[model samples]
Target: MTAPTQERYRILALDDQRETVLSLQRALRPRGFDTEPYTDAARALDALASQPDSYDAALFDVVLPDVSGIDVLRRAKRIAPDLPVVMLTGDERAKTAVQALHAGAFGYLTKSTDDVDSIAHTLAQAARQRLLQRRAAQLERSLERVYGFEHMIGQSAAMRRVFDAVTKVAESDFGVLVRGESGTGKELVARAIHERSARASGPFVALNCAALPEALVDSELFGHERGAFTGAVGAREGAFERANGGTLFLDEIGDIPPAVQLRLLRVLQEREVVRVGGGAPRPVDVRVIAATHVDLERAVSDGRFRQDLYYRLNVVHIDLPPLRDRLDDVPLLVAHFVAKHADRSGHSPPTFSPAAIEALCSYDWPGNVRELENVVQRLLALVPGDEIRPEHLPSRVVGASSGRLRAVVVPEPQPVVDDLAWTDGMPFAEARRLVQERFERAYVTRLLDQVDGNIAEAARRAGMDRSNFRRVMIRAGVTADKPRRA
Candidate 1:
């Protein structure tokens, strides 16, 4: 079994009174914290300025010989704006505390008998606040690394709202259903949520129901007991068990089979899962986050999916706009992708010429952000010059700009079961059934791809009312995400 993760708070304590500094350090140390006490304020300020990210918060006595604690607070704020700084003072004057607060101290506490508990409590609270801020920053950095904007990128007002939604939901335990078209970075949204949530320290387990075989899907989700099935060699935990106290992201959840749907619904409702062969149900504290690319409500109406599970998973819905809708962000995304690949390739970053930028903005991104990244990589590989011009881009992109390729809107259609006849003369009934299934699967997959695998939007596009789409997805053998490759 994996060890429980510990939350560590690093504190820098500065006080002219060595005894007081030692007391504070001793009090904080037992709470799973790392304390660095300094009698000299100048030394603490220097240390803070040099390595701002190293500490969670700083506690400083109001007065010091080398520098006033207020001055230290200012320096710390400059170095780390989000870092909490609390002032410790023997003075009882409210005005003094106000001044300290005005100088950017998170809180001011007098070194009085009543203030000890308050100080300790405030310190712990400050540590938590600082930790949250740090997590948000880390998430932003991760988003920038993956798809820019922490997975949701845009300068448009609509795009900004999406960004705001992500930040707002990150601090909560609510299950978020991200809806968007293919390549819209839904998985990135999931990552940001996981990183920002309390479960940030826990493992993030993802599985795409549509990608796995129907027979193996259940075993993949709720681990099979040894000897439960032909491939079961040993007892193991499923995604639900693995993500206990963490997040279980089910991508393409609209593809889950009817049998698996019942089990999933039971787990969500009961907060426990019974392994394939196990007699008893094990409690699981997983946050259920499911995504889908199919129109689940339509599937439900068509009698291909379940309806009950839909309402269970649509707690918080986040709609991710397609790349085509947020065209203004193309330049930012291009520069980000170029810089990213260049860093990996160890080559000088390529500059985009005005014409190149225009071409990118003009082309209809059928594949969305993923397609954009691939194009950027292709340009980097093919273009030798320092500047990327229109000629450096793919011919399709350039041709699309010149009206050689017209943008076509394909109406969302139900999968036709008989469309797969070219390869094998499997009986028409079976072929038609498979084709219809494949069409629904492809439709959902494309929608997921369009919205970057955000299930909510995929459902909406497929004409599934938000609540109904979720249920149909579960029954249609759809999982929220593709399972992690072993």
Candidate 2:
């Protein structure tokens, strides 16, 4: 088992007898345990309840003044189910031992044992087991942070294809063209590729072509000698020279001016760059990753983007699918965004209602993943409660799902059995079946309606897998017309 950190493992110990607590602390303290002894069981229970994950393991005497050890053990398990509880008592009855173990105690030991060595040994083993279990849980959480690539969360077939392409292209230094809609994380994909490449240790320089002025395009791509232009107060290295032995990501490459495009092409072909207004050519061992949302082929045909430069950057092409095409990944992406926002805001992640998730999934994300993240952040900041429901979602999202605004129209309250009339001679089993059917219909109908007929979202809210939830809907004879196909 993995041991706790090098510092003493914090153990919460409770015993009605002050002397016994003192003895326990003395015995364990010498062996690298930092024990917090409490004579009253109430205080110990309170501490555990308040900070469930703080202590590595807890020790309780089977008989206590405030409460029974069994009761404390049961409550501790409820507070922190994974917390290891070891029962220690002066009584050595087999029945007590059975009760302690049955109540989720990791181990049971008698204080009257002649071997002082055995007491410490048993406690140490239980504490180590708890530490190891906690460590494993921590590792699992860390693993959850990674999906397809660093910070790129998606499991859809479209994303898997992108991941596969990245893996193949990252091994080489050939120029790559990443084509995707705006806010589709083109730069993120480029960074993911560079991270997996041989030049991972090298710097990644990024400059957006569309964001830069036409005059600055040439100076940005290639270094400029001192006094090369009005702003050239000092000799400065451009993106190519600065990104030497690394990667240069040119975003919106289609927007690059014609003259700058030729210089970029030469840098790619000759693996070198000559500073503007300078006679000397400086060789650069930099990989080029260009991204553009515009149709480069069409641009080339229109005499806009240079055909040769387009071909050079298009050695390997990776097309990121828009969020609308990969709607199945919405739930995953929403969860990632929620957690990311919650961490930054120092707030516990609020729950997303099935209806809210449905609204998110049904809408065509024209702004893509970036837009989704922004929406989630907005909800986190504005939503009052811990649960984000359909009513809490922005009206735009609800309307976009069906291209028309839909509101939850609550019908006037009526008697639950108003629709069903039970006859005096009705059999018990038949009456029960009818009541069950009515209840199922009402429950499923309300759930489906709240989610705007998104079955997947309804199923998630019901805490069941999609298949099982679908079966439940079918069993209840409930049919829902969703805005989008799951």
Candidate 3:
């Protein structure tokens, strides 16, 4: 396959001397750079103001009749902060170079010592730096879109419903309850709510109720006096006090002990919290966003969770769908995880083969997105091949294919009741081939039937490339029988 070509970097050259401009144009054009030369510095400055993004780098001559290159650099910076500027000067004064550097010039080249090679080399470096800067900026913006207000990445209808609910609840001051299976990003949803709310500027505090000991839950939620408990060395502020005028995310809220639950409910209702072992109640203006993987209703019914607390937190609810239900998003999620981990480790992520992707999509992700990310990290770390095949996947992921395709997999054909009469009469090889043919036919029939005669899903479930699977179907004489998707 042909590799994709990169866009050529454009250079804006501003020099009063036409000869000097010609020299630069000749030097750079051979190196595959597009040079836009200007004899008037004023015109160049105007272009910079109007079309700052059109050029990747600028080369400015120090002395111009209309305006000094330094002035142009300052103005250009104000208009486009990221544009790389390289100063060109006939004067070899060290102070001039110093001044250019102070004005944010990426490079300083003197016309006397500046041969075609040197000028090209310096400008090339500057252009490359510009490209890097642009890429870094693009990455930052991409990350913002991925991890911003709608940070939970999903295009599925189920996730769209969650996003809609979050947007509506964010404008209100009602307590929010985020419910999902573990590793489904309950905390991300909670953070999205807080960031979208009026309290976005306020501190966002998080406390995992299940992570703390029963003895420390109360002290952690509502601060404690210096002598409130044995480990209470100082007058410490809790999540509630610290998150005043902001948000406090209480994760695993259902796991909190009953005593702490009561205190949490009171704080939610009254908008105040009395520190542990303290008599006075202090007013706290905090929004609480609670998350839990367990069903709070079931916990409440079982007397393990408090009903009032559940109701308080459930005023605004967002139920995140598990990864298996939104399998259509698996590819997108996989690519995202690969890029994320690759960036962290400073390595290129391996590409997944059709069979490898099929293996991933076929498996039911019990641990959800978190597990998928972990697997991607593992693949990047361990897989030496550029392309990841089915063999590169974890055994569990590949093994899941059988379980998922079990309904369509052909089982061994049973013998007629009380007999091996046919086998007794036939040759061993012939009988085995006959049984295999029957199994193939049955497997194809069951697969096509399960997918409503759609060959695509059947092929996918079989963990074969589409074209290869089609060949298998043809060889098995099943292609003509299965209907194509409309």
Best by TM-score: 3
RMSD to the hidden true structure, all candidates = 23.1, 16.9, 15.1
Q: Whole-model lDDT for model 3 versus the true structure?
A: 0.77
Model 2: residues >4 Å from true position, as ranges? 1-146, 403-486
Looking at model 2, the pairs that clash are none
Residues 166-242, model 3: lDDT tens digits: 89999999988898999999988888888899999999999999899898888889999988878778888889999
TM-score of each: 0.53, 0.58, 0.59
Worst 10 residues of 2 by lDDT: 405-414
Q: Mark the regions of model 1 whose C-alpha exceeds 4 Å error after superposition.
A: 1-151, 403-486
lDDT of each: 0.74, 0.79, 0.77
Query: Candidate 3: minimum summed lDDT over ten consecutive residues — where?
Result: 405-414
Q: Which residue pairs come into collision in candidate 3? A: none
Local distance difference test, candidate 1: 0.74
Arranged by TM-score with the best first, the candidates are: 3, 2, 1
